[model samples]
Target: MRHDASRRRFLTIALVTAATAPIALRAASAEAAAPAALPKLPATDAAAKALAYTENAAAVKHAAFKAGSSCTNCNFFKGAKGQAYGPCTLFPKNTVAAKGWCSAWAKKL
Candidate 1:
């Protein structure tokens, strides 16, 4: 009876570990493979300069810039609503501040 109980307990442990091992391994691999966050676009970048991009919309002086405009409200901005910084269509590889502005700013609607 004692030997039978030991064998059953060992078998149960081995089965449980085998069932959960793949799931644990997959979760670890996915975490490791996750991409890092994108870099922020600098206001001084050549492309940014051409568009008159500014980190703060209030400081924009371009003729095309309108009062109360910013990346959060622009058509080219792809950031989620309320995000402080996010990716922009114009600067594909970099994120922009939600309050940033540029000549290309257009109504999201």
Candidate 2:
């Protein structure tokens, strides 16, 4: 009875591991294969002006623009690995320039 219990426990562990291993591996690979970073948005875009966006944060003219803040360092930036442009939560379906700045920029935690 002892041997039977041990064998059953081992089989259960093995089955569970086998079932979950593929899922774990697939998730890892999917992360590795994600799309490259998006293109930088034009500073002249209407939306850019509305948000007081600037390719260079230091160049922003808005009274609320902070001198040292930039999109690359903002919480809203979702840049991909090694790229200068990425999607911003503030601008759905549009990319923000990495060096850009906006009034909505928030320091990434």
Candidate 3:
């Protein structure tokens, strides 16, 4: 009709920009391959020496340290309560220190 409706609206905008250009270049290469922070947990790693991890919960002396246990109140701290460092479902991809301590400290219920 009008040159076949302008060639079917330019082939439906070139088939929706070739079906969304590989999901917008894979979401901009996953936000430029993430990792801008996460990287602290290093008290000699190996799972921070099998959970004796201490970034200074009053310099833990073990015995499953308790007097006000840390990692910003444990339960595998994910950070935010006055964060001095964060993430720690037991150091996945690092970051811990909010006055850390480990022996898998729980009690964040």
TM-score of each: 0.67, 0.59, 0.35
Total clashes for model 1: 0
TM-score comparison, 1 vs 3, better candidate:
1
lDDT by candidate, in order shown: 0.92, 0.83, 0.88
Question: Candidate 3 clashing pairs?
Answer: 45-48
Clashing pairs in model 1?
none
Give the CA lDDT, 0 to 100, for residue 33 in model 3: 96
Candidate achieving higher TM-score, 2 or 3: 2
Give the candidate order by descending lDDT.
1, 3, 2
lDDT of 1 by residue, 1-109 (tens): 9999999999999999999999999999999998789999986789998988888998877889888999999999999998999999999889999999999999998
Cα shift from native, residue 35, model 3 (Å): 1.1
For 26-94, candidate 2 gives per-residue lDDT tens digits of 999999999775456776778877888877776778888777888888999987756677899987657
| lDDT comparing candidate 2 with the true structure | 0.83
C-alpha RMSD in Å of predicted model 2 compared with the true structure? 4.8
